[model samples]
Target: MAGRAKRLRIHGRVQGVFYRAWTVETARGLGLAGWVRNRADGTVELVARGEAEAIERLIALCREGPPAARVERIVVEAAPDEPAPEPFEKRPTA
Candidate 1:
């Protein structure tokens, strides 16, 4: 499978809106591996690794998160150094 990895920072109405859980579910459904956490700065951060197309689909889903989430923006960056080998998880607040 074609693989790709990325670190994403989601902004605006992300925290306290089930964004992390939503992300975990979404990523897992896409068969991606990574983790999602809430940032102290009121953003949601995620690291995802999987098939290039699947990862892109997951990223797109992040752009329009859960029903309660008003995802304003999502900053996606390449993370070629770190890789994950499990299903998505919801990490503790940071």
Candidate 2:
């Protein structure tokens, strides 16, 4: 399987809107590996590893977030220095 990884900083009204839960579900469903957490800066950060196409799909999904979330911007960067977590999970805010 072709592998890819990315670190994302999602902005806008993403907190307290089931964003982490939604992200966990979405990433798990796609068989991706990563973790999502709320950052102290009020942004959501996601580190995901999976097929190249799946990672792209995850980025698109994050752009829309959950029904209650009004995602404004998503900054995605190649996470080449470190690998993502083993499994998709919701993590404590950082």
How well does each candidate superpose onto the true structure, as a TM-score?
Answer: 0.92, 0.92
- Estimate, for each residue in 26-54, the C-alpha lDDT of model 2 and write its tens digit: 99999999899999999999889889888
Q: What is the lDDT of residue 87 in candidate 2?
A: 71
lDDT of 1 by residue, 1-94 (tens): 2378899999999988889988888999999998999999999989898888898899888888999999889898997666675878888889
Give model 2's TM-score versus the native structure: 0.92
Q: What CA RMSD would you report for each candidate?
A: 1.6, 1.5
Clashes of each: 0, 0
Give the 10-residue window scoring lowest on summed lDDT in candidate 1. Answer: 79-88
**Model 2 score (lDDT):** 0.90
